[model samples]
Target: MALYKTIGAFLLFLGTVSGYANPGACSGTCVNTHDPSIIRRSDGTYFRFSTGGKIAVHTAPDITGPWTYKGAALPAGSSIDLGGNQDLWAPEVALVGNTYYLYYSVSKFGVQDSAIGVATSSSLDVGTWKDLGSTGIRSSSGKPYNAIDPNLINADGTYYITFGSFWKDIHQVAMKNPPKAVASGSSAVQVAFDPVKTDEEGAFVFKHGSYYYLFFSKGKCCGYDTSRPAAGEEYKILVCRSTSATGGYKDKSGKACTNGGGTVVLESHGNVYGPGGQGVYDDPVHGPVSIRSRKTIWLIMLIIFALQILYYHYVNTKIGFADGQKQFGWNTINFSSGWPVV
Candidate 1:
């Protein structure tokens, strides 16, 4: 049974990502964001948060939106001594157990000194957030990993955070509920590393079917000055999956993610350059949506709606319901062979 399930999952993964087009990109109000993260509210408002002063906020009624700047998640900056610039980066938001957890990075540029902090809000609105201080995850000189670019995921029954950039690439640690702190005595584990062993960040993980997929960006992430980027330095997204959420992730070619293996999910295409710093939201209307920020923010909304419909059609037809009617029921009336049943 397990083997059959695994085979089914592999087939689904292959079929879904095959010839995938670039997710629809949106500009105007959604552009120019640094490390943007998006989440849909209960009321259907799509809120986007990004790296900037007080963690900038934007909102729109739909996914492809004329995103209007609403406010900042943390207006006063972090309580920690973040090396004086008082700016935040990589805002990752998730609603877990009746509270909205907004995690942001507080650090000085190009330095190993950094901390991933958390803010709590019952209502995901600006100024309603109360600082919960740091998550006790930090990095400094001589450490293998730099603690930045935090992404929170609630997998199975446990909450885990995947973070870090450059250096040793991305790492993950278990979190306690309310998501304010790492669980006591839980050692951080390195999950995904860049093949060149540099510049991997914005790691997000989610489970689909029987596998847990890890998505991360690699290459030169912030070089907006296109005139001077090194060869293969353009940031791109890649993914790998494992049955367990903790580790042992592998790409489509069956290479382990720990060995710097990943299937390229998205990269530079058209006007979208250096697309990275992504987060995924399971929208009620569209299922699971993967959101990433680039030279422009690509929302990738509603496209999954069509996929969902097609998946239903695929499953239904696979079970011999090709005509949208089961073979066992009276509704399976033959119309082509004779008169339709009343």
Candidate 2:
């Protein structure tokens, strides 16, 4: 009877093994890329953007693609140089009506002197981009504030820009038209999560199921030895939701985001430091989804294996080995030594 029971368990294990495949396949780590932005066209093509003030086009029939890069959307000489500009970073792309707008920032890392600018393109295919110039948003010294990363979202026929970094606070500016300048007297307001000292950038806001979701990345970004690899140094993507676009956003634990409460939507799986610059797009195959580069899924799988091993030892010690042998649990394995494990 015991042998029969063991055979049955073995059969079940085989069935599970046959049904379960690897977690997912992702190329090892696409290096030299950070602050990724994605846009899906009506024709089922995807265009992605990064910090260098350039946009790259990738086409795929599905969202999870063998995404092939066509070319850069912004031309070589299209970069902007604001007062004492350093480098262009953190590009956010939005589509409204028939036009596509690319919002980007110019700043030195760790400096509040940053400026955000816009560029418009009627067709995202190849040529057709026109730089709409800067919005005159700057810091007190006539220099740019880190608070200038622009994230555009339209609500109720009116467009709103959520722009800010860690220096001051995240602010919202309303626009009468989509992808245009803010309305007169539309001063910025402190909204969503605020970081006391850490730099909070890449603020992306969207509406889902009557709830306005605020997604932001906080912590250090874009430096090799810049404390990102250490614990708490890792950048994480956090999320909060509210009924209104401006206030009452709360985490899953029901803590208000205004009080610095946030639920982590995504985090670095492994060597994927600062996997924060995110964008959402509508795919013909997967409906609405987000695309951002990170460490490959293989790293996540290794962590899962390590956790399973630790759990197996913990279960064997807590519960008697013989009793554990008969217990049904996830991914259980029975060894010849009468030890049952996961």
Candidate 3:
């Protein structure tokens, strides 16, 4: 009987350590963590980048972390100045061979003068990031037409980038190295899509199970008032899938993405408003998963829950002993009864 109890206790401890759902499964207060780029390191840690232009890391022995933030990967002074008030936004990160590349947009809202820049970091941790400078792939007028928001992917040893906001349409350019943008003369194909709203942006591409998934966000971002409906608005993450890398993109309803085809993957459920700017991470343990933030009370609740679970397990393991204990009389408990008191 002693050996049996010991084995059962060991199994319970393992369950507490290993069992968890994907972080992306979180609903409710999950808000506007837009334009997210995710990567799983060789050591099983998952790092993410977003429009904040500051990269964040989430380390878990597993994919579902009570994910703790380890400070900004890009320091406060690392951003490039594109004149007045134009800050960094919509960061896209990709890993090729031994190097990691970060592409981001530098612009202010409603401004045509914006440019995209690239930064490189071998480690995702804080202060290890280095800016590689602008891609030089400016707009047709040589000005920033919000030309900075970039999504990068590697296919068969070639690097391809897709970018652009609601100027005309999204544009795709091929790259040979980290900061070198595909030359203007190279065949840059416009992703066939018409914007329903000028605030539409945050484009990402991923190849999964023979289908290439193109994800984008539509509606206003970062604007508290100008962007409408508050939390549960029309601004949400949408997806289109194609068999080819750059063609045949269509919504689940069979509408062509070239003609505004999109299907919502993540949207506001209640107070969680306008969750856009998303990137997919192929997690080591949970497979492909997404990490986005929300603006609401619910996210606070989620954070509290996550923190509580982590603290209880890693910091307060003694408290967990009472969980499996059986309650006897009023205000009394007994672990000797074992679990599921039959």
Candidate with top TM-score is: 1
Which lDDT tens digits does candidate 2 get at residues 198-264? 4565777866557777777776544434222455654556777778886677877888776676776
Cα deviation of 333, candidate 1, in Å: 37
Model 1, total clashes: 0
List of clashing residue pairs for candidate 1: none
TM-score of each: 0.77, 0.69, 0.66
- State which candidate, 1 or 2, has the greater lDDT: 1
Clashes of 2: 1
**Regions of model 3 farther than 4 Å from truth:** 1-34, 53-63, 76-81, 84-86, 140-145, 195-199, 225-227, 230-233, 288-342
> Could you tell me the lDDT of residue 115 within candidate 1?
88
Candidate 1 TM-score, C-alpha based: 0.77
TM-score of 3: 0.66
Over the stretch 1-342, how does candidate 1's per-residue lDDT look in tens digits?
A: 565445445444543565333344343374446676778788888777877768978787865566788788888888976673278888888888788889988887789988889999987888899987789998889888888888887786788999988888889999887679999999789998866667778788865557677878887665343243565576666778888888998888888888879877655544334555665545444443444321322223222221220000010122321222211100011111111110
- Runs with alpha carbons beyond 4 Å of true place in candidate 2: 1-30, 53-61, 76-86, 140-145, 193-195, 225-229, 270-272, 288-342
Model 3 per-residue lDDT tens digits across residues 1-342: 675455445544543464321123322211223455556678877554544435444344443443455655555533455652234666777776677887777666666677777777787666777876677655545432357678887756667788878776566777765435775466566664665644456777777556777777776544443434443444566778777776677887888876777776555432234445565544323331222554565343323222111000010122221212210000001112121000
TM-score-based ranking: 1, 2, 3
Candidate 2: clashing pairs of residues: 114-144
Error of 1 at 170 (Å): 0.8
The TM-score obtained by model 2 is: 0.69
